[model samples]
Target: MTRVFSERSSTRATRRPELEAAVKLAGEIRSSDVAVTLVVHEHKWLGRGTELAMLTEELKTSDVGLEFLTGELKGSHGPSGIVFTVLAAMSGMEREYLRDQEVSLRDIATGAKKGQHSSPATVMRMLREHDEQAATAASA
Candidate 1:
């Protein structure tokens, strides 16, 4: 029944629909003398931990009650808020690792390292880039 609304005036792109539905449902309940308890998933903001909590405080006790918590921190997500922080971090790290792998390929193409794996793809890319650099230098 406690009207627990967040400081945030708007919802994130992914959460907007659910939050809007809650508000709409609350409006209907408010028109009546009935009280309802609505359970919603808890969500947190990235780098701002729970900065944009949902409209729990906004619910009127006389009309409805709203609170949500999962068995684990179902709501604790990363910057996207949909992906858990650890997963998000790991995904980025994976991409970086892939890119780092390409560095060795580049080394092989430039004769700085031995091509222990696929030789053609990396060398092709290197040749293209080398030609581009040469053309730019010629124009300069």
Candidate 2:
């Protein structure tokens, strides 16, 4: 929960009603310094990365601790710094996948030139293995 919801409040950046309620609640009860856990079924509920980063920082400023589980990212996380790190890495991750795709195309093209498939299977296998490893790490 990240903000107090009001029907008249037009500035709620996060679309999740529960988050807004939680934020409101946390602010009210923050004298005891309790942490809030926010569960999100969709990453979009957090809005853009910048929005999320700012929300976390706001929580910290108000002495409200925040922990979150997001289905899109599929993990439980706390700490505002981690949000910035994760957002920064997202573009690099996308770039890695895009480069892999290009490599696959080049690999097959090179094989075709020689009348063979130059084993693009290796690239695909590596990608699958990477996926498996990531799943394992996430589950752990």
Candidate 3:
């Protein structure tokens, strides 16, 4: 991946090997003086809540920063921000859409358990169910 940086800031892709190394080093240092912000292409990679949570915790403890959208910092950071934002947003949205696929897969598994045909087209119902369950669990 490209190492994009300016006088006061720097960024790396979510899946970059350099970032992995940096995180490892940061873990060893455990110094509050070291600050790093990891900016995610919010539209591309933030869909995995568990992954995000774990990474966030690791980075937070090591003084690393996580940014969800680089496009928002365009014009202010680098020449690529404006163009990257559109691509990043699209990527993030695409991942978000896969959660729908997860709902379908869950339905399919449920149907198999019940000896019934599964229909994955029920987007509205699945979203509502997921939202309500998430809210209930959150409150609990």
Candidate 4:
């Protein structure tokens, strides 16, 4: 079993009942450790923004360790940093999407030509288009 430590009296602990209870248990047992097994079921657990951010923080901080209780499970051990990295990238993409939406609204208001869409998938597309434009300009 893996053990995770919780900082008692933390603001987050107060906010989250699970964390608060864990903290209380740790205090009662004279050990600041809690064991947790992470199971992702059909991507539902990761869909929530607040939950995702909290879980990421929990994984990042303390002495939290990941363990698979199921014998049939075949995957990499422990929590991977890739999860957080992907989350961060997704967050960036979301920000970009919002920015693109704002730009589109502004363009509409100003009656400017609507250009290419600024989306996560369009990142590479935009780069390719920019490169092509640069190449054409250079040729000219």
What's the count of clashing pairs in each model shown?
Answer: 8, 5, 11, 1
lDDT of 1: 0.40
Tens digits of per-residue lDDT, candidate 1, 12-130, equal: 22245445665777668766856555554442221111212223223432344433465233432222233333333333343344356774434432334322322222333555788
Lowest lDDT sum, 10 consecutive residues, model 2, at 111-120
Best candidate, TM-score-wise? Answer: 2
lDDT of 4 by residue, 1-140 (tens): 33454333322121455544543443344334544444332222232223334455555454333333333222333445454544435434534554566755444323243342232234435556889999999999
TM-score of 1: 0.30
What lDDT does candidate 1 reach at residue 113? Answer: 34
**Where is model 4 more than 4 Å wrong at Cα?**
1-31, 48-51, 63-77, 103-140
By TM-score: ranked, best first: 2, 4, 3, 1
Q: Clash number for model 3? A: 11
Local distance difference test scores for all models: 0.40, 0.46, 0.40, 0.41
Candidate achieving higher TM-score, 1 or 4: 4
Clashing pairs in 4: 4-34
**Candidates sorted by lDDT, descending order?**
2, 4, 3, 1
Error of 3 at 90 (Å): 20
